[model samples]
Target chain A: MPQTADTNRRVVLSERPNGLPDAKTLQLEHSEVPTPGADQVLLRTRYLSLDPYMRGRMNDAKSYAEPVKLGEVMTGQVVAEVMQSNCEGYAPGDHVLAGSGWQDYALSDGTDLRNLGQTPQNPSWYLGILGMPAYTAYAGLLEIGAPQPGETVVVAAASGPVGATVGQIAKIKGCRVVGIAGGPEKCAHVVENLGFDACLDHKSETFAADLKAACPQGVDIYFENVGGKVLYAVLPLLNAFARMPVCGVVSWYNLSGLPDGPDFGPAIMGTILRMKVKVQGFIIYDSFPPSLFKDFIRDMTGWLESGEVTYKEQVIDGLEHAPAALNDLLLGNSFGKMVVKVG
Target chain B: MPQTADTNRRVVLSERPNGLPDAKTLQLEHSEVPTPGADQVLLRTRYLSLDPYMRGRMNDAKSYAEPVKLGEVMTGQVVAEVMQSNCEGYAPGDHVLAGSGWQDYALSDGTDLRNLGQTPQNPSWYLGILGMPAYTAYAGLLEIGAPQPGETVVVAAASGPVGATVGQIAKIKGCRVVGIAGGPEKCAHVVENLGFDACLDHKSETFAADLKAACPQGVDIYFENVGGKVLYAVLPLLNAFARMPVCGVVSWYNLSGLPDGPDFGPAIMGTILRMKVKVQGFIIYDSFPPSLFKDFIRDMTGWLESGEVTYKEQVIDGLEHAPAALNDLLLGNSFGKMVVKVG
Candidate 1:
């Protein structure tokens, strides 16, 4: 809640971006707090999740999800509290995970809201580890990448929510997890905190060679999140029958146009053919069944409690910094899961 | 088996060519037929299978299979007559499938030979529809492609062995099959003889538009064998959750260097992510279980007998034509399966 409780502060897409979003791309606006109608709950956002996928939604391109229209509330997931409720299942003071976008308050009919009850432990976590990003990591690595016990799994954006979770899960599956991060600090965190076998900094001059050195047996499962230089480095190092579960391409998300080149499109295709690689692009919501989320929450909760899996989040206080935070997330400056403390 | 029966003629990789293999790329040489040692069978080549995978073996670059060295006999599969046998299943009149090179006479230790019994029907068929190419189509299509009924399947090199078999099998499974071939004649054969629902001439100026028109439902499964212009066309038309079973890239096989461009590499990866596509590259021999071949042969044999399937081979007469036949096969000139009649 801001100083003025009666005013609902929200961020709306003002314009589409050509490359990195400028300050004017998203505009902060104030309006009267929305009233709950029949069968609707008035929710006040406590935390708003800023993710790389939001960048794609900003583009007016054909993708898994529809792009956010100009002047519309920017699409996002938020962990919020119900201030008033006429909805049957959700009551006042209930903490619910809602697709409320980047806002202070929202009215929901309870269809997209996941009730977490009052005073839920680490309620903000619903926007990170116990929610979409971690779930994406779990499903993509287990279902598509299918990491084997002795196989090597290389993940990009290693300290980010999805990559960290993927690396940790791969470690749990007894795989050799090699992580690639943008900076030395994140790389260290991936190895020391997340318990990955090795973490290579993509910022290194010999990053590609470093990746090859880290995985001498060749990468069997590449949990692809960042798709520019990391992808190029990982391609030649992929073993026969390598599986690449592509969840994000944050590195290329802001690319307005293709870079000049001896186009490597054919070379990539040729390598895929010659190496017998399996590259699958997937959106977690579209790829996995809803029932799997329960299993995931159960297993992840157990893993967290047992000290087997760890999570880290860069929580930015105040919702006003979200636009800049998202830019940092896309540029690989965020050390881990990037989230906003809205209230 | 030849005009000079005692002379064993073989084609050796005289030199590796930059673009396409020219007259100087392979050299024909004559030698006295070697005597078979104990447990070895003296085989006289009857038919040699000329498939596109051979193009990859000509390059020195590392691939699934080792490259054919400078002075080594050009690698290929052959249906041959067992002229002499010293051990176990001793027979002189038996026909067998052997990993014999481009030579009339070769000694196999029976380890790599599959005995086809004397007086088998259409012995040359063993080098084609019953062998690697057709089996590749069967496994790649059914296993990886996994076409559902009424779904659209777009296959390139649609008149060639793999593509033809894939389209036919997709039809058997109740798919709307679209075939893409180089010219009008081959496209006609793909639709009429191969029983595909539609065939688009890839040589047409409006090939991309023609493909879009032909596949009104968009491509659900793309049985990718040729991956140049055809791949460029298919990428945009792919439906969500589309599966691409990449079996070959004959178009890029002869390329000495990559084409200059504003690189489409990032665009390809972006499409893969946005469309949620599955692209799997595979070599038939490496992908399937050994037992599946028996199942394939049985099912394929039944389909042929019941008139549910058909096969065509452009059999080039003379062992001397094997080099040119392989060149033709890579160039997409030979219609259907290209085989050299060695006997």
Candidate 2:
């Protein structure tokens, strides 16, 4: 499919990060394009999803999921095309989304491939709204948060994949939705496009007060994806019996370990107890019932078909450029779901 | 009724404790017992239940229940006998349990008195196994823990009233119960008398290791009342899907404030996320349901009658000595429920 035959290109974990990782921590090198055997297909990656969970896999410590081993391909989920297939059901030219990692091409046993069908009007949507990030938001917020009509629901990371879905779903449930993002553009998109009742920018100098002013009716459900100063700001604004679904903690991920600064855990715990709130950290796979997945797919497909939920994607040009894209995502510089167009 | 027309001794809060209260913080005095009104019944304190929850009342901090104000009588659940009655249902010589204070005579409007009736094998048992403490244990452990048969359940302050009942109830539910207590005598009481599968001494140099050995299957439900080194030891031994019903914090009551030591709050948060463990704090009055209270009374009464469960009482001599008894109770120096024999 390419003008040149593909050689190897992979990113390896050079060393565990003591704090935030620098470019020196990741070593990119040329290697052989792995071959496909019988009942296997060679995938040419078209899009790679950069997510907060990738930070967890980069570390060797125990977490909800397994960490990627050193000297291995950095693990990720990607939308790729089958270059050649010697397996049943999957054939050459078929598009699929699989955990293809950060590489130009990967050999799959045809076991993990989910067929993306023949025609995709927006192929990158598979890496955004129709993907793991979307599912994480849908299941965690709807099932756990259980927002009621007239309730005020708030979500941080307002423009990102998970947070966007969370705010949109809360709006669907008839709750007054508030969004918190990093900049004016993202905040504008959240309120105008996502239909949030109000949006606040965390980067604002008066961010905490802005959040408090936006939600005059105290927050009933806070989809907690960020646990830093934003969380501290959100705590006092939380009403009695608030539900906090802990989907991610991107702010602390780069720290390598618990920060040595003033610990905010006590403050959070005290707030939870006093407010009679429930803060539950859930891995989407474990928390969502299979029935939820069926309902999500049906509703989400309809929303996409009807244009009720709009999505944004920031696409990187090539697999060679994925490292920079990942850095931008980790640094919260990328505006939306940052997708690396690998092939 | 005796040499004196009314008992005049009372213990009132003189000064709030900086950490844990001392005898000097409480002032015992001779106060006149006023006559009862048309709807009021004068009660003579028989047995006052010295519970760990009273520690919170000593501080002015907001909690599920209001804190005891300085110069007011120390609040407690008391087994008292009606000396003079002006209400319709209650009369002289009737015994009842009331939320009377640390005083010789208390006047209640008969609005909140729970008539214990005249006959009892041991009236003091109403303050422990047949009382609020047992109900607290039962309601929290069964309603929240939801321990299936064969699950390993652990409880701290094992020889204390609530912990003893918690371990016993879990055993009744067909669980392997491990009890953690302060010393050898109490630990022995937990295993031999309360029928715990195993018991660990918290004061031991090898406590953590001993706890691990005792819970080879890992702890599924930890009835967490005392939160200090005991919680630290239990954290690592907790299995996935562990449930922690936090009914009190007796061990921390002795301190005026946080130790000049490293806080374990962040570590606790990280652990909860990694294990999907649920740690819930509840007050008996706020979250304790009456249906569970009836169920507990029926089951615990049966257990007591059948000789399956036994409790020890640490009775002090007079109402005048209740302040010292309370100070001892808060310090965990009293072996059992510190009751004032105010006959």
Candidate 3:
């Protein structure tokens, strides 16, 4: 079942899922390789970055970005190499960061592609630490959370790219960083490797008490990514004048409708008012001024080189494994930054 | 009964209310009028401001400020005239804005009083248009809501002091302001008198539809004060990157506990993430820098003098009417700023 020279392989949206996505949601299809039109470039994807945000794009619901249409190639960011170029600035063999999606090859007009040049230290790194997730961690934390020295910063999904980066950055800024992860192993890694002051396993029955004990001063800034029980636990622990930069709520992505219970809306509102907390939701690109990205790159690169910031990648080989990998990511089974090695 | 010259009439917190304050919550008492000590001033109250936030201070719950103690004069801001002074800066007959609470007479150490000097025009104006409520509206709208010109800014409790001030300021900033009020009369006042672009009656069955029709561009900034059904309706209409400066939730102030229903917390979190909205809750003084107050006073005074802002007051005649006036304010029966003429 190897692809022919004239053919391109892609994963397309087969059907929309009701709650969690399954294997049947996406289908692999083969078509004649698209030719580069005038002012267009042919891109061969080397790595496809799989993120929790993709779960949102799968639904035909209104969001900051449009949902992927059924029978269309699944949208994603990819580290790709230019195969053929009809665009003036792009040339064959040049590496780039582009929204080539879940595909073997894509036709781009070079409008949105970022040239990574002929060779990058690690091309796939551009898809994770040097790309959107890192930028998200930087912008959301520094701009919204605005953690100060002696403040306690808490983040969920501690081993994941965004949370790991956020916790480390907080540590670098002379703050107490506590991470919330799902298992003991992840928790240990978060504290031991990521330099977090403490890491609490949210799976434990005493998770709330553990978090309270760990953050003696109460949480000043909560980098909210996972919402549900974690959010509920974080709510009471949030100190007066706390800042919650909500970049994602991956846990609630699969919910069909409102959960069955006494509404917590009033309590949430009450906490917000009584504590004078600032809970701001933002997408990285929406909030980040393009000028800040240059600073982000310089600082992040230095941190990476100094070993102050470490990143882990769960590389699932082949584009065909993307569906199962994405499902694993949503299930909290993926250990780190989940990226598909497409080429 | 007429108060004797030697006795001071005061309202005290008799007990904490479970849901809403009633007749038994506050007890009227009389005490000997205290003589001013060294560096102190004796004051006779002229006006007492009644606000919905006082309802929160009645509860034995943790909040930004401490609850009113049992059998202590109920906390409030007042416009008062100095009767005697041992303090260097004060003199008899001087008007001042002070936290004198619900009482006919008080002795201040001249610490927190803002001297208004002798017979200033409308001294009670400091308790409404020139004071805390106006400051709340100014700081929250300009600092948090940050409404830009051509953007649609929505606010609730449209004719009340804070809401009225917020709408007028938004209008001054060239934003298209839409107000949500309880009745047609209040809505009419909001649009015609307060200079809002449109005002919707929340009591109408087609309220949500009316809001939609009025906000054709969708809501860009929601100055959240009334946070029950009004908030629910506004949630769906919030545009991408919308800013919600949550200054109050007066509608839920009287609830004994959480409302019974399927939990909308997850839905709120989801909407926040998908729409990339910014929801920041703040208390006026807590969020505003002290330096901003001078600028606020200068600009607000200009606005008032130019007829760019107008205000209304529902003034009760006596100190004994304070509790009922507060209840009326919370119940949305009070037309505008609720105050007690205590002199």
Candidate 4:
């Protein structure tokens, strides 16, 4: 069943799901490996990054980025080996960061492909801590949240890549960080391993009360990636002039519609007005400047080397298991950064 | 009643209303005029400024500023003429801006009074165009909204002081300004007199469609004062990186609770995330520094003198009519700035 040069294994969008996506949403098929034309490079994907934003691409709704078309290759970011090259600066056996989709091999024009060079300590690190998730945490917390010393910083999905990075950075900046996670185990990991001041389990029956008890001075900066109950609890605990850098709303991503009423829109708007809160949303690439990435890379590398920052990844074995892994991510069943080792 | 130096007429908060304030909410009573102490100044009220924020002060709920206590004189801003002076910077016939409450006469210990020189073109202008409302528009729009040339700026309560000033300033910045008002007359005034590119009547059956039609390029900045329907309409029309300076939520101020079901909080947050919107709330005095006031005064004075900025006021005749005038303001019945001529 091994793929030859004449055939490639790939996953394509079969159908859009109504709520949580299932096996029927994606179809695995075999196709002829794409041939690289002039100025193009052929890539064999080694590791594929799975992120929450990909869920948004499944819907037909208008967003900052376009949705993945039906029956087309499912879009994703990958760390790949340049198998063959007809373009300058690319050579056989070189690794690269490419948008090679959910496939064993892809053809790139070398236009947007980034050369990761001949060797990396851990190439999979480029898919997590040294990649998009970490960059989102860095730019959003520093640029938008702007946490001052001794301020209270709270973030949801505490054990995940973005949230873990946010909490750790806030600690480095001398702030009290409270993290919200789904289970007691993740909460323990957030506090003991990630250095957050306190971690609350959102699944607890007295979650709201626990969160309030944890944030004695109220929340000054709320790094919002998960919405729903966590957001509702955070709203009341937000201090005056709180800054919220909203990067995702993973909790509601699978829901077909809003929950039942008394509509909380007015309450949210009213709280924002009364407290003078600043709530802003952003995409990592949109706000972070290309020039600033050099600084980010330098700082993050130092932090990792010094053990000031620690990272965890949930590695799924094969590309065919991506659909199930994505479901686990949406349901909060996956820990840390979720990635598929596809080599 | 006319020549009473012995008795002073003052209004007090009788009871907090369930929703909107009525005649029963405030009670006027006569009491003996108190004598001023050594460092105190005695003043007779000239023009009393009635603003929308006073509605928040009437509520028992928590807010940025303290609520007015039951049976205390209803808090307000006033332009008063000094009848007697025992303070260093005050003299007879001096006009000062004071938080003197709704009354015919009051005694000040000179703590929060600002001395306004004897004569000016219009003393009441300090309560509107030259004062808090104008300053709010200046700081919120310029500092937060940051509307650039060729961008579109939208504001609600079109003919009122805050909205009018915001639109005019946006025009001065070379932006396309669209305003939302309650009626045809106010809409006409916003377009013809204030020079807004277009003004939509929120009271119209097709208000949402009309708003979309008016804003062909989508809204870049939304100066939100009136919430409810106006906010709902503006949400979908906001462009990527849209900035919303939430100054007030007048439309929802009188509501006892949130409106019925399928909660829109998730929808609002989702839109914010997808579009990368920035929504911030602010109170004028909290954000603007005193040093910036000098610049604002100079710029506004020049604009007024050059006929680039015009204003309107709905003057109510007596101190007895202040409650009714405030009700008119809350209900959107008042066409412009609501002021009471008390002297």
DockQ, per model, reads: 0.80, 0.30, 0.72, 0.79
Per-residue accuracy of model 3 over A133-228 as CA lDDT, tens digit each:
989999999999998999999999999999999999999999999999989999999999999999999989999999999999999999999998
Predicted candidate 1 versus true structure: per-residue lDDT over A101-143, tens digit per residue: 9989899999989999999999878877899999999999999
Model 3 spans > 4 angstroms off = A1-6
TM-score (all chains, Cα) for each model: 0.98, 0.90, 0.97, 0.98
Candidate 3 structure quality by residue, lDDT tens digits, B79-198: 989999999899999999999899989999998999999989888889888988998999989998888999999999999999999999999999999999989899999998999999
Isolated chain A TM-score, each model: 0.98, 0.95, 0.98, 0.98
| lDDT for each residue of candidate 1 in B87-119, tens digit (9 for 90 to 100) | 567499999999888998999889888889998
Compare candidates 2 and 4 on lDDT and give the better one. 4
Model number with the top DockQ:
1
Clashing pairs in 2: A8-A31, B19-B255, B19-B256
List where candidate 1 sits over 4 angstroms from the true fold: A1-3, B1-3
Residue-level lDDT of model 4, residues B1-343, one tens digit each, is 4425677899999999888998889999999787889999998998999999999999987788999999989999998889899999999898998899899899998889888878756888888898889989998999899989999999999899999999999999999999999999999999999999999999999999999999999999999999888998999899999999999999988989888988888788998898999999998888668877788889999999999999898888889889988988999999888888998
Output the lDDT of residue A90, model 1: 87
Clashes of 3: 0
